[model samples]
Target: MAQPSLSMIVEGMIKADSPKPEDGWTLGWDVVVSYSEEEINKNLASRWEKHRDEMIKEIETQMTEERRPGESSDEEDERPTCDIKLELGAPRIQFVSATTSPTVNLLLPVRKGSSKWSDKQKTSILPENSYQICLKNIPLGTVKGNYEEIQDKNRSGKLPNPTTGEGECRFENRVPDHDPSKFEVSWVVLDFSMKEGDLNVQGQMAPGCELDNVEDGKTKVRLARGLKVVKSAAEAFFVGTRETKFSPVFNVLRHALVTVKNKELPQQVGGSRNLTPKKFRMASLKGSEVKPILSLFIHVVDGVDEGESRDLQTRWGGLWLNTKEDVMAPIPSTHTASILIHPKLIYKDVLSRSLASESNKGWRFKQLVGVEGGGIALHAALQCEFRMPSIRLQFDKGSGRIQVTVDDWSKDLKELPATIHLHQRAMDERPVISVNWKFSTETRRTNSRSEKVHPALDVYKEVTGDITRWKTTFKLAQDVPMKTNSTDYDITLEPDMGKLSQCWEITEEEGETDVWDKIKNFFRVAWLSNDEVFKDLVVESKESMRKMIPGFKLGEMGLGFFLTTNLLNPGAKVIRIDKDVGFRAPGNLLLVGHVIQGTDEVKSGKV
Candidate 1:
């Protein structure tokens, strides 16, 4: 049966904006490091070791200063928020550069046709046929170099000068090769910390904040909180480089060599209770986040971890994912060979727990160079799983039904029951008719011959009864129509003598018998009333049936008066009838075919 269905809503639970369980959530900075060939070579990687050493030294100095109770970083961060932006430049990944060049002043004699070559000696390529000379490829776009030269002496009017009286020239012809870290783009937690308020209110997001799993985040996540990350599809950050020679012959006879040592990030958790190895460069929170932790994790979406185990039991440990991986790394980014060859040049560290954003907006990451050492010369940032926040649900529509044990009636129903009951009483009750019904072993048929006569209902109707103290097989006394007609919505008992007869024997004084009644009264008119009677017994029976089966058209088929011989008169018949019994009875409605669909618009079930 299909009663018109309506969805039941449960409020105050999770909504559409809620994060899903599958999206990993963590509490750290989503660090993005970017670098370029120019920035990494001459600007950073060339002198990276020196810069790293200086950074380590600076960190050590600050660590010493921090140990002294009187020193504080607060004093340095006291600048007003407005001036800080003007004071700070773009977030930079810095490296040490050579303090001095290996150039010296020299005077060479001017020659005949090579006077032009001699004038531009410092920046030009070596002569093609010169001895002890080498050749190298220049960058694709550059056709000239930036070089400065000075005269050997103050010249007055003299004969045509040769070689422009060469003096000293100093210049840089090409950018040097550097490691990936030198090219890295980085930011500091201190900068973010001091200006957190400004960053949070900005209308952009730091790198890796935009994700489909994170709703409205493309607009909600802002980068004003931190610097935007440099990204490509293949790597978190990438920068191309070119091979060059200061002098055409420099790569041959005695190729110049520059060696920069690696700097170890010797960091220990200030407040942790766990024991970690002294040589550990990255923050090892007693976990295997090593292989999996990257400055940024790429391509993690519904398609990545679909069939994989995201459960605690199947995790690296018996713990859940406490970190949120980066979801926004660009698709075409790449990891350079510099990263593979020189790992220490890459700096990474986990920050304090408080640096993470409420949403995956950004992470508060740790840096090896420390807060006091961040600069264009120092490479510092975080490396760990980027865990973020998400939402989960526990219920759905197919859960069948539930039993609500409402403790406070007013709170749950909002006092609707009282109002409902009052309103229900205002509607008029349906009209009803009543009749008396009883069942007993005492029937009008007292002989065995009458029982035999009434045995075959298909043949004809006959009168039969029993006078013994026994219960009747019939449970109800139903109506038998005198004739078929369309006027009835109720059952009425009148005189019937075509085969079996039933009548109401009411006490009355017949002052005079009309001609029509006198003739018919002989066979069927055993009652005086024009219509069948109804009383409390019948009305109550109908009401009881209505209450028993809800949403039903009660009394549409007429009410059946139930009777029992158990209480009032044990051997007497309270209900009298002569008819077919059981499923074969004339008044009983029985469906005989297979029930498929239904046409009742008010309710459903039908045959």
Candidate 2:
């Protein structure tokens, strides 16, 4: 036998018309709640019992007190002796499938109760020609009487005498007697529609009951009034702050992403850093118009300019040292490490770029700051630019993976002064003139000098060489498994270094020199002198790129949790999950699984 399957898809856009079951995939949900007719009746009966005395007192206040025919006017008149009973019929719940949204029709029939009137004396209190009074105007249950039988007797001039107690005499003012069991006043009809994450209910009076004096119409109006109160209460609780209609779901998502254990993400993708998500939004996919994709904007961390301070100090300090004839002479240079730092080094800018558009692609960070503290040794600036590719989440059937592509990266050393002082001399001595240089890996350059006289020249060579030799593309893939218990399920992603690899090309500039040989010669000498240091730097750069995988995994897990938890019915238990679970294009996360309905008793068993 095939297992029952359930699929839930949150589309970018929903049609006005509700989807039908025949659409192949049903809305992922399980009915874990039910109410029996007997249970409903019992509850109603208990409510009536609690307020029965108060209701009777209210009815008594509306009734008029009349004395017996033989009683004296001076004597205190006795209150009318009255008794009332209420009964309820079985309730019926009807599911309306043809409506635009999910709708339920609730029907409850009320049975008319018999009433008895009594007097203290055994004698008839009514006069000979007296007629039974109708309390139709009273705000109470409908009254039944034999009006037709009495009218016929009156037409024939044969109305029963009340003093003889032979027959009943109902006045024309009394309500016409119909079937005792068919009282419209006791019936309740309510329509409940589930639309746009809200519950709307409407009360309708029973058929043929239009008068406000009628019991059925009055009850229906009161029920409608009560439902309005309920709707307001529901809105207040669920629509707190109005940030999102489903704030609880978002809260769960935030908790899952922040708390879920993904050790590989911090260690491999980005170093040990806190993942602070600033804001989240949902939007449609670009071009395809697939809607409801979740996007998270993270707080930006300051990118360390370690090379800036170190390189600037070394270059200027070295130039000062090179100009001195004696190596032991104290340098007069005033450049300090702190003053050489780049302005706006801290990255605190908010991420406002759109990730949905293919043209825009990813988040971009760029900054330009004048190189500081070289004094007369150097006058230059640095321009840094990098792009963080958009993270794509895909799931088809059962397998799921999160991916990111990083390619755009460039740094330029601009405004390099053309003259330098190689030797200390008189104040008016002319400085050695050199050709202008734009040292950047992004562009090609030709230098007259063969030897690396300054550290900046070595840096340019190193950057160009590394850019050409290192693998330009890095891709990391890992399996995210759903952990399930009898009552709940969770998704966890751990980075697998074994699955991490790099294989892609970076577009090269035209007419660029092939400097692989020159880089090899330079690295050969450096490797012999500082092999461990070079190895550590390479490891650090690779580790930084690796961190992207874990970060993407964290996002994927958060989205998965948001979708799954929303589909779950309160108190429902996970019975089985199909092996196939993943994301689909056009913006959809599909989960095929089975859940034990909340109404069912769940036993202690493995999921």
Tens digit per residue, CA lDDT, model 2, 1-607: 1111111112210111222211211111110111121222233333333322221110110112346699786966556653322232233333222333222333332222222345433421111111111101111011111101212122232223212111221212323564332211100111121223442223233333322433666554643443332233233332332433543531210001101111222122122222221211111111111111111111112322212122322232232133322221110111000001111211111111111124333323232222111111222122223333322221111121111122344532233221211111211121111112222233222111122336454321122122222323332222222221111232222222132223111232433336775666466444323434333433444454445321111111121122122111111222233333321111111222332222322121110
**lDDT for predicted candidate 2 compared with the true structure:** 0.23
lDDT by residue for model 1 (168-256), tens = 11211221344322221111111011111111111122123333324554332422122221111001101111221122221211110
Judging by lDDT against the true structure, name the best candidate.
2
**Candidate 2 — which residues are off by over 4 angstroms?**
1-94, 98-102, 107-501, 506-556, 559-569, 574-579, 582-585, 594-607
If scored against the real structure, what TM-score would every candidate get? Answer: 0.12, 0.25
RMSD of 1: 38.8
Q: Cα deviation of 357 in candidate 1 (Å)? A: 24
Best by TM-score: 2
